[model samples]
Target: MAESSPVRFGILGCANIARKVSRAIALAPNATISAVGSRSIEKATAYAQENGYPSTTKIYGSYEAVLDDPEVDAVYVPLPTSLHVKWAVLAAQKKKHVLLEKPVALNVKELDVILEECESNGVQYMDATMWMHHPRTAKMKEFLSDSQRFGQLKSVHSTFAYLGDTEFLENNIRVKSDLDALGALGDAGWYSIRAILWTTDYELPKTVTALRDPEFNEAGVILSCGASLSWKDGRVATFYCSFLANMAMDIVASGSKGNLRVHDFVIPFKENVAPFYTVEDSWFGELAKSIHPAPSEQQVNTDLPQEALMVTEFSNLVGSIKGEGSKPEKRWPTISRKTQLVVDAVKASIEKGFEPVEIIY
Candidate 1:
């Protein structure tokens, strides 16, 4: 790989999310789409054409073909949760860096296997948590870290929900027991859990207790659920995710001296700019008649969409390994594992009739 050449990415599926990511790869200056694969060669070819992939982009009938392509330096895996471990490990074994979709695995154990394969093969691995790459997220982190403004965190709450249509409720792979068994927890709650952990700098909670009476489909798949996480220092966080509510994505964090709120945490309502709210040193006037200084709005602008930024970041890491012979970045895989670990704990708590599950790591 030449220093001047862009990192070559091979997409492993024609999943809907992959369409968005393919555009991001095209937008990223450091990356380019090299190939796309599906079980059906015609589908792969059509996807490439429909997504405006370059004429040189290869279309393959199987994921293995993409991994075997010498020109491909990395693979973007948008496969379902059940297929992630197999394809991700195979990609790593082929020495191709992996950019995996969110809810990276069915469980932490599976995640560990994927990570081990990537480590042993010296390939970069990153989960597609695009919001982490957003400029607004960094700005919000700065506010949260300010001791004078935000003080010590006391509590946090996050929610992500979207009402599913009849077709989706009946046919979506997300609700399929054999495909995405984790259901809404893995799809929507993954973002909420990651957001909560991000506020605490990825610290594992001491315990997790799922809210009682989770709704389920006929196949025994979760349709809606919530959980509470408690830290040893008394910091508490709660999150809810569902496919039975109007679309909403929010995170509210309260501290000793300040509070923060964001209405759009998963995907910004707008692609170019994102806004958040915060209030510092809030107090009431005499007789609690009036509040002093209302919450302020902060907006951050981006040159490219967050997903593109994510691709650029992952591609940069792959480029370093390919061009400079550098070691794979550990930060990505570490955060991904921590997120999965917490997710598993929440699922365990639900299975145990909402009993509190202690987090070991």
Candidate 2:
């Protein structure tokens, strides 16, 4: 509640996502990792130690214990999609601000309840969507809004896919039976929806439909589904997501005058190839060059730390909460609305045998 105070963040899980976010929280200004909770105390303590966090950061055996700590000013929930709503509401009820990861919940109904709880508690509630906070997306939005580059926006097509490990498959929470609906749609595919909604000012279609292959791994939990989202203005966007395959994770936007193609749009600049963009007069004018991998100068394997964009953004939200006026509240209404709409549409399509369903927003 104090204006000049640094916000204390207590993470709810020690999953891989948590490691990346924790690093981000450490880098962001005026944010501190006061505590971290995991299902195992040893795991929590080890994570805290390995990550260079203060030893004073208490390790809790349960998430609820972290929420109950008076020192924790805000909570970050990176649990499975179905569990998001339950823990979010509980955090709000405890009077803690929340930065929940994507999908927020499995459906609109769950999200509505979480939103209601936040409103009732008078606490800040945000979906932890780093793409929305990235500068590249802002540039994309600018180009999409310009009349010359984007007049009468016609279509948006996106693909988000990656391969999963079998060993990880053995112990991962993602493969659990209790979290049936928390798959690629709720995970990576949510990025496609976020992109279209944010770039198009949340003008989406009334109907949506999906086709999926159920034989895959994460696909079994949440299928690799593609959807055709039809807008009221006759503008349609196509979306694709998969956890069983590897894709470039590209997002292409087509309009009347010109088109924009972004490869690795979701994790753009996070790793691998440098996150730099070069604008060209035409997309087809580009040539692909294949270079053979040169042998390493040293016969040693190197490790690069993971990206913490989510945690950095969450910390910024905390700083905003302590700031005079936060713009995320006034500006993020469209994000919240569109997220629910896209999620609802996708779930409906999956449940009805990939039938075309209408979006209420």
Candidate 3:
């Protein structure tokens, strides 16, 4: 690959989420769609055409064909969770950087195998947690880190949910046991868990306790769930995710000196700007009748959507490895693994009759 050329991406599936990611690849200044592949060549072709992929983009009938393409520098994998380990490992083994969708694997054991392959093959690995690339997220981190204003973190809460229609509940891959079996936990809770981990600077929680019984479909896929996480220092966090609630994405973090809140944590309400609220040293009035000051709202603007930024960042890392002879970035895979570990712990807690599961890592 030339240093000045955009990173060439090979999409491994025609999953619906891949449509959005294909646009992100095209929008990213450092990346371009090189190929799209699926079990059906017609579907792959249609996906490429419908997504406005460049005319030069190749369509392949099988994922292996995309992997074997010498021009492809990276792969965007949007396959279901059950298929992630197999395709992701193969992509890495083929010397292609991997931009995998969330719930990277069925469990930590599977994720470890994928990571091991990427590590051995020296290919960059990043999950499609687009919001992490948002400038608003960075701004929120700055506030959380401010000792004088935000002070020491005390607790955090996150929620992500969207009411699913009848068709979705009956036939969506998310509700299928053989597909995204982790269900709503893997779909929506992934973001909530990631948010909690991010606020704590990637620190592993001491324990996880699933809240009560998780609602599941007939196929045994989770449809709604919540969990509580605790740290040795008494810092605590809670999160809820569902496919049966009104759409909502929120995160609230309280600290000794201040508090922070974001209603749109997974995807911003608007593509151009994102807003969050915070209040420092909130206190009662002299008469103890009311709070002293209102929370201040802050907005962060971006020219490109967060998903595009995610692609740009991942492509830059791939370019560094391909063009500049740099080592794969460990930060991304580390954070991804941490997030998965927490997710696995929560699931374990739920399976153990809501007993607190101690996190080892």
Candidate 4:
């Protein structure tokens, strides 16, 4: 990378989600999409053309070509979970910073392999959890951390679901056992698990118990599932994820002194501003004397969307390592691994007759 140049990104596999991240990379001040690769040259070329990729962008027929390109500084991989460990590790081994999609791997063991590769190669690794980069997320956390208002956490409930029509259920890769084996638990539940972890300040729960009513598809892949996580302090969190229900992504956290509610924690209804509600100590005995209603605490505003912010943040990290000789940031991969650990525990609980599975980590 030359002085004052943007971090050039090479996109691998051209998944549908790549379109969103591609636009984000183009919009970010410190990032640019240098190349896009797929299994076929026609698809790569046509995708770049149809998606409005810059004329300067290179098109490659194979993922290996993108990784071999000397002009590319980093890669954004939106491949299926099954392919995550392979491509992510390869990207790191090639000395390319990796911005991997959510549900980083099928298990913690796979994630550790990817993380080790990045560490050994001295490359940055970040999971593409766009909401974490949002300005609203930080604002919401501030309230939860405030002792005067939120005090101590008691319980949290999270829900993420969307109706999958006839076409998606029968044909989508997520429904395939070999592609996204965790299905709804991995796709939608990952967000809920992350939200619970964030609310608890990244504390690993003592145990995880599946809700005992998980629905599976014909291929034995999960379509709907829920899990309960409990901590030693008696703090409990429950999350529901599904592909059979209407669109709903919500979080309700009740603490000793106050409560917090977010209607859309995964993706806000509006792109520019996100709102969260909070209520503190209040008393009620009569009809209007004791009952207190929480109002929107803040409408967090941002100049760019969360995905663009994510791209910018990742680019800056890559730039620091390339320009300032800074070591790779360890915070991101560490969180990603912790998130995967909980995911694995949830899967185990579901497999073992929905019994409570202790979280060793």
Candidate 5:
């Protein structure tokens, strides 16, 4: 990667989620999308032209070419969930900082390999669990940690679901490929666990029980799942993830004095939907809409994509690397390890007729 003025980014693939994050990257204060790579040169060139990028913003016919490009300082890997670790290690080996799509890897072993590769190559890497960087999530963490308010929380309940995407379903990437490393567990459950762990800072669970629909093939890709978590600290969380359901996302925290519920836990709306010009605005208003509003310390509300926040945070981490900010911590490893524990527990439970499996982390 060349040392340009601002950080230059090359996208590994033109996946749809990559488009969503490309917008975020464009909005990022310190990043630039210098190139996009696609298996098809025509697709890459078309994406470059349609996205209003400079023609010099190279459109490579192969991912490896993009990695070899001198102008690309970082790469966003939005490839299939199965290929996350494979390409992430390659990107790091190419000396490119990576912002990888979630579930970081299919399993604990793959995640470890990716992390080890990044460390050996001295490249920064982050799983794209953007919401943890959101203001609301941080505030929720503070509120949960407050001994006076919500002390020693008993349980966390959360859900994330959506109607299956037409193309994704027909092609059945969710059910067919090795890249389909997980079903709802990898897709939505990751966020539910994120909300629970990030908010409460609980030790990873000791046990998990999961049930899935038989037709889903891989136990990970289920129409719906119900799982129970027993954390090491005696705290518990119950979470659900589904692909057959309409978008109904929620997270609830029950503590000693009061309870807090996050409606639309995944995507909080900032601006109300408009007739013709529906802008994707901030989520503050929606987040604050029906707060219980505790007397002494108020509940918090903010709507921001986790990706944007995560990117900003990563940028700060990079600056810190250059002695421009506080040193970054090994947060990604912790997050990856805990998330994989949850994933493994769920898979084990489903395989064993919903038998409870102890959480190793």
Candidate 6:
């Protein structure tokens, strides 16, 4: 493949989330949708038509055909969690880069297997955590990294929730125990956990403790849950994720000398611009009447949506590997593993009667 060529994407399965990713792949300057596959040719054709795939895109009845297509440089896997390990591993063996959806696996053990395959096959691998590629995220990271602006971190709090209507609760694959076993924790909490880790420079917490009284469905899948993560230096991070609450995606972190807050950390309210707040070197007035330093809002603007940026970034990495013989990025898989480890620990804590679980790493 030429270094300047766009990475061709082959989407596996016609999942709802794939609708957004399909658009991202098209919008990305360095990527294109080459094929789509489903259980039936009719379904695949319908999906391609409904999703506005280009006429050049091929429709395959089975996922294997997409993987077998020589024109496909990569495959986007948005299949159910239970099917991830099987298909993702096969895709890697087939020499196709993988852009997998979040909650990468049911557990870290499963994720390791997938990551190992990608590594051995020398294929680029990245999970679809769109916010990480957003321009606003990078801007906020710049602010957080500035010692003069945001000093040593003290605590972090995040909440990601959305009210799932009755139909969605009953019909969505996320609530199905056999499909998405982690449920709300895997769905909403993945973002919250990622936010915490991102702000903390990808540091794994020392311990995790689940809050009491998690809500669950009849099939015993978690519907809502919260947990606290603590580090040895007294830094603490708390997150609440649910499918039963009103829509909210927030992150608030306080440092020794600065505070940072963002209302929409997962998905921006608007596609083009995102906002965040910060207060630095603030001090109470002489009479304790008011603070000396007022909080300021920072808005980051982008021409492309965050999801598109994600596709562009992933495609760039794919291009590098194919054009320059570069190794796959290890940081992404490591971050995914850390997030899953915390998730596993929180579930363990909830099952152990809210006991604090010590994280070995």
Best by lDDT: 1
Error of 3 at 226 (Å): 0.7
Give each model a TM-score.
Answer: 0.99, 0.83, 0.98, 0.97, 0.84, 0.98
Cα deviation in Å at residue 236, candidate 5? 1.5
Candidate 6 lDDT tens digits, 177-289: 98999999999999999999998898888889999999999999999999999988989999999999999999998988898999998899889999999999999898999
Which 10-residue window in model 6 sums to the lowest lDDT?
1-10
Model 4 poorest 10 in a row by lDDT = 288-297
Candidate 1, number of clashes: 0
Mark the regions of model 1 whose C-alpha exceeds 4 Å error after superposition. 1-3
**lDDT, candidate 2, 191-252, per-residue tens:** 88787776578766788887664334633666466788877786788878776677657777
lDDT of 5: 0.70
**What's the lDDT for all of these models?**
0.95, 0.70, 0.94, 0.92, 0.70, 0.93
What's the TM for model 5?
0.84
Poorest stretch of ten by lDDT in candidate 3: 1-10
Candidate 6, residue 225: the lDDT equals: 100
The parts of candidate 6 lying over 4 Å away from their true place are 1-3
- Better-scoring candidate (TM-score), 4 or 5: 4
lDDT of 3 at 28: 88
Shift in Å, residue 358, candidate 4: 1.2
lDDT by residue (256-342, candidate 4, tens digit) is 999999988899999999988998885675776557654446799998999999999999999999998999999898888888898
lDDT of 5 by residue, 216-279 (tens): 6434455567688876676778888877778866877777654556766576554221011111
Question: Which residue pairs clash within candidate 1?
Answer: none
Cα lDDT tens digits, model 1, 132-212, are 999999999999999999999999999999999999999998999999999999999999999999999999899999999
